[model samples]
Target chain A: MAGELDVGYVAQLARMHLTADETELFQKQLGDVLHYAEKLNEVNVEGVEPAAHGLPIFNVFREDKAKDWFTPAQALSNAPRQANNLFIVTKVVE
Target chain B: MTKRELPALSIVEVQDMLRRREVSPVEVLESLEERINTVDDKIGAYLTRDLTAAVTEAKKTDVALPLGGIPIALKDLINVEGQQCTCGSKILGGYRAPYTANAIEKLRAHGAIPFGRMNMDEFAMGSSTENSSAQLTHNPWDLSRVPGGSSGGSAAAVAADIAFGALGTDTGGSIRQPAALSGVVGFKPSYGRVSRFGLVAFASSLDQIGPLTKTVHDSALLMNAIAGHDSRDSTSLDAPVPDYAKNLGRDLKDIRIRLPKEYMIDGVDSAVKTAVTAAVKQLESLGAEIVEVSLPHTEYAVSVYYILATAEASANLARFDGVRYGHRADNITNLFDHYARTREEGFGAEVKRRIILGTYVLSSGYYDAYYLRAQKVRELIRRDFAHAFEKVDALASPTAPTPAFKLGEKTADPLQMYLADIFTIAANLAGICGISLPCGFADSESGKKLPIGLQLLGKALDEARIFQIAHAYEQSTDWHKARPKTIAEGMKRAGKAGEL
Candidate 1:
């Protein structure tokens, strides 16, 4: 599909692997999606403001304070592999 | 009681039995186990059923929790403290969550036992569960057909009697559409009604969590248990949480339901139209003033939803870099290889497709034209709903364009799958509340019985009125009582039952 972005690098950056067939399949699908997205280009935003939400979006943050949480053991219980209160994983940055 | 018979039990009935000691929590949990074991294989409704863990929890509770002894299904996207949270993809296959979602915490506090995780579309992207990339959850009524997806497993699990109710998230039609297809009640509350603290994100602005159950009253009960202002979820609503279960089954003599003319356009199946029209008549007979309205921008909802949904999904799913968590590729030649291989290995075809589409739309020089514009269209769609509410109390439409389609029928074509959600997508795009209720049934010339759902959309936070109309409708009809017999027949082809 023409004008399709080569997202291969980003997919790789995200630890995703796409086969040649999938890459090709996605290129077409993504291109079509973007083509359809071009309808958004028709909207006039000149002198119009961009709003984050239709309704007011407020930061409903809780007061910063100490709070109790489950012990590290409980949190790591579902990790496929964990060691010494940390989730074990392969090295990323060399 | 046979497990088959147990699927028909309402949450209130089950809880009442528990309160009276007529059914022990242990016995209820055991029956749920038997039901899950018996039907889940054919329906593919559950990812994991923690029989031992649920039993342990039930045994520990000498005094029943409010929802104790009541079985419930959890959508796989949410993290359960010690259960695998796959998000219906291979990438996070066998991945367990370290902490429970805040909503799960609330359910546990209310004594709800998590029966198991239900299936979903991979990363909650597809309108059908076919994208699960693990198992295809057949519609409980018709094993050969799909249970509407992303939350297909949860919908099927409840519809097939594996659980009295289930929790599912909605990005597009993940919850409501599946509920419609599966012959159950599914509600997607206004965004942030339920906390999103632990749900795997597909589209943040569009995502919501709600109940899928056998009845409207059950959904209301579950919503009351889970809906609240949670500090952990920034988008969580600070509005006062109403007792959703209050005023359920009330008279709707003054309730005005608007039938949007835009939804009844060409391409809708004849049977779906017939069923929805019949349902409208039924609603009219019960005192609802049916009015005609127009959502002029309705035609563009799917396009806007796709763009915005993919863009947000692309950004939100970036955490699975194979390094931080989930499947990682070994022997990485470099950082790029690790990312590519892990994502390739971890995510399935559908998830990857959305991620790529999202990346393209949000990429440099494309952001304003794609993401920004879609968001604007999204605002317009919401305004359309708001404008119509001035004319009526709620909007009604067919939940899907048609009944459940054959398995593998549209999996090869992503556009067809997206189109299946054409009707329900508008609700999610607008962030309004909507519920899909089994209103009627259709008989194909081949003599197959398929359930048709009618969707009731209410203004944001107006779940009470939606439940009122749905419960009233169910009382006037026996559609909810007509369970699909094919679930037992495992009868290879879709089967026919007495039609509504």
Candidate 2:
């Protein structure tokens, strides 16, 4: 909750290619949320453990056997582009 | 029964009629289609509904099953195999789910017919449905106000009598707030009570699926069909799920309901505060011992929730990068540029704002200061519940600080909108079960009677207890029996605006 928010840096990190107007607007809005969240610093949490989730969950092992799964055609059903059961995307390596 | 009359009935009533062979599933579909046709043009509660497909599926309804042939509307984020799972974002435009989610699979297996494509805030982010690029869903109580979101469509449709029951996801008050605003019964099951395998993820840790319906008993019926352990959702509790409807119709003989003074703060609307106080007094009259309690950390719940929820949301939503499915940017030769450009265009203003805020809090320099501190504070909030529940059967509070506001009331100020959910978000933060049911109505400035809700919070996996209490209160009052006056007005408005 500390430090003035740099919307440009955060948006870049977030992959939100914002326009100038969006950048200016988000800077002010995100600043307000962060400002409101400054109240968290008041609570003393010196020795408390951080809870990753609401409940404590230990990993469970499922039965190690083959099960009904999405077929290749099914997996490719919503693909923006598909060829030979493979999802097509822009070339990663030029 | 007349097709016009069927849509107004509850899930239980329709199920009884269906079981007695008084009306077939086909009739229910026709009835819903008629009602939705009459009112939905003004409400904007649905993105799409396939009557042809629904009628065909209804033809095979089996009344012997619990939800058999009963149509339960679904919030758009939930996936039914091959159905559009847009989550009200243009990013998922033209995207159909590849397979069904675990909860829907359970519901479908129990003979429930998956009905309409209910609207929502894109990715279930906003408290008001205004953020949805799909359409603005107006409150059924007043044509000019909002149906609270991100389950706006789900709540409005049920309140408007277009559907008997609905499935909505609550991550920081999405379900309960909307239900309160729309004057319907909405229950957010304790986290892990329902599986999230098929839900489009938003703030993963806080997200939960729940029911919005006409009555508490109907919520319990829908909960029974969908809630149980699923091996698919790793966080789902493997513990037993009780029949949520079994202990209903009981008096609160020795139940100790607590009143958290922190929730009765000064900022709450006088009408809402008075109504909630009366509801608590009603419970006391029913033999409940009202004990005043304190959740000292209640002041920090919203702060902790925004920090943690947005942090998780930023990561979960990173999957939508114009690659596998949904909107893909054209002429983006660069792969990285493709993700950036596509998201900016496909997502709405609110979604992007949360993502950026989320990314900020979780980013390197601020990680320990914001995210870690919030997690620790979250533990404090949870401990408050753990201690309070040790002595009480449930905690009573107003669901939202105020009744439904006009459409653009809080839209410009995002932080003000976030504070509207202050009362209900803590239950989600603590990972406990909570239900919001109609307690009374408040007169809006327009002289329209807007519904206010009474919220009951129970311990983890204690949905049955709260349902029992809520059902008793609902049975004793005529609040749930009140219907909106907007249908005829909507028809008149729709005839004129072609745009209402």
Candidate 3:
């Protein structure tokens, strides 16, 4: 029931690249893990509702009041590089 | 005090000395630094040491606050201003936090000295610290084996006596599992009991910050120091923080302890089962009654946890574009290229794998099948715990199936790594509170001994009762007095033979 999930497919999905060996290794491991998870399919769920958060669901809202805010300079002070009230980095748009 | 000698001091003893002025904060800091220098090489506990700043901070604290003058190691995820908050990742290798975590700021206001950062699984994703991009932290008990993690460094550091106590974060058993593995006391206060303002999110809904120490009393002391609501954290509960230390030594004469049948399944290591059963017998001797209970849906906990935790992680990690303070790739031409190349270069394989699985679960078409279904199952798991608690005062179980395994033993298989947290994750999934303490030692067939832990689980805001039972159990057992042979004998060999 196992098949080769190519390195390019994983890389494309993960948004990264890996060497051939790393790809082969991860492919085998991830596939094995998912197959194990599929073992859960053997269980029967009749009408059980999934529990998310512990407390009863409630809408937590604060009054819409404006408060003091950090200055652009202060907020951007720890940026590796910054200019003109913005964090500067490598060119992104081709 | 030698490296081994310091690990045995109770937090209260350290605080009392600071109050008496018999030992200056600088002296305590220096002693811990000496221990770290001598002990950490064997344990690999500390990730960053801010000695100059710590000494400066200690010098400033001429007067002790409640927990002031006590040395504690901050988990790497917490942001301490001007110190690197690596979160045990290569991506944020040199990234120094611009501001301090709200919890750290509160600790400073009360005079607690920040010793350094501890290692963890990268972004707190893995249960074992093996996923740490930095290095493996060895169990103080046996150097070849692991200390439980993603907060493994903090747990090992405290276990080795490098510091009196240390702060660690838990999301799916990071704190308790490691504490159990290392033969120390680890407590996770009720979610929202402590602020999570600066902890790097692994699974936000599941994460809670707590303490690891040598005793239940010390764990409660640190909880009193750190537990309170903060306006900065929207999720922080607005309840009053109680004086948890007051009930530490209370008698648990008639407390009803529940033994969930689901937890005592086949496949639990015989050694761990024996230790936990023995711990229950000791509790019964103290007049506590043990009752068998059922949590029928226990088998679904791990599956539900992985789906929900990874889904959240996928969303939480989207900010690391390499443009924001983390590592960046060279010659990135497009936004997609920037995200892809930077993350490719920055993140470790485990981190990337989680992101991919997380992304898949939350993807447009599969969202309902995986993510939504997991959420509903999570609700059922919580209800299961709640249903059982109605009939008992608290619940008990072995914290993990086995003690700390050797490094690289489970790293190859992610499922095997995930299984390390099987027993502890249920509490996180249910959003209840739990604590782990040394039960006894498990005798290995090879004549090596490993520590086993017994977990005490309680309902929301009932930490006082949990502490009472844990303290009572500690009072009746000598298992906690046992430390690693290396640490205990290392001090004697080094000529610091005052106490063993």
> Candidates' lDDT values, in order?
0.79, 0.90, 0.80
Model 2 residue B257 lDDT score: 99
Ten-residue stretch with the least lDDT total in model 3 chain A: A1-10
Candidate 3 segments exceeding 4 Å error = A1-14, A39-49, A90-94, B1-7, B62-64, B490-500
lDDT (Cα, tens digit) per residue for candidate 3, span B263-288: 78887888898989888888988889
Instruction: Judging by TM-score against the true structure, name the best candidate.
Output: 2
Backbone clashes under 3 angstroms, per model: 12, 0, 9
Candidate 1 lDDT over B155-265, as tens digits, reads 898877778899999888888899988889999998778999988888888889899988778888899889998888899888888888787868889999977888898
Query: Pairing residues by index, what is the TM-score of model 3?
Result: 0.94
Docking class of 1: acceptable
**Model 1 vs. true fold: TM:** 0.93
Off by over 4 Å in 2: A1-3, B488-500
TM-score per candidate for chain A alone: 0.81, 0.89, 0.67
lDDT of candidate 2 at residue A27, scale 0 to 100: 83
Work out the iRMS of candidate 2.
Answer: 1.0
* Candidate 2 structure quality by residue, lDDT tens digits, B67-163: 9998889999999987999999999999989888898888888898899999999999888899998899999999899999889999999999898
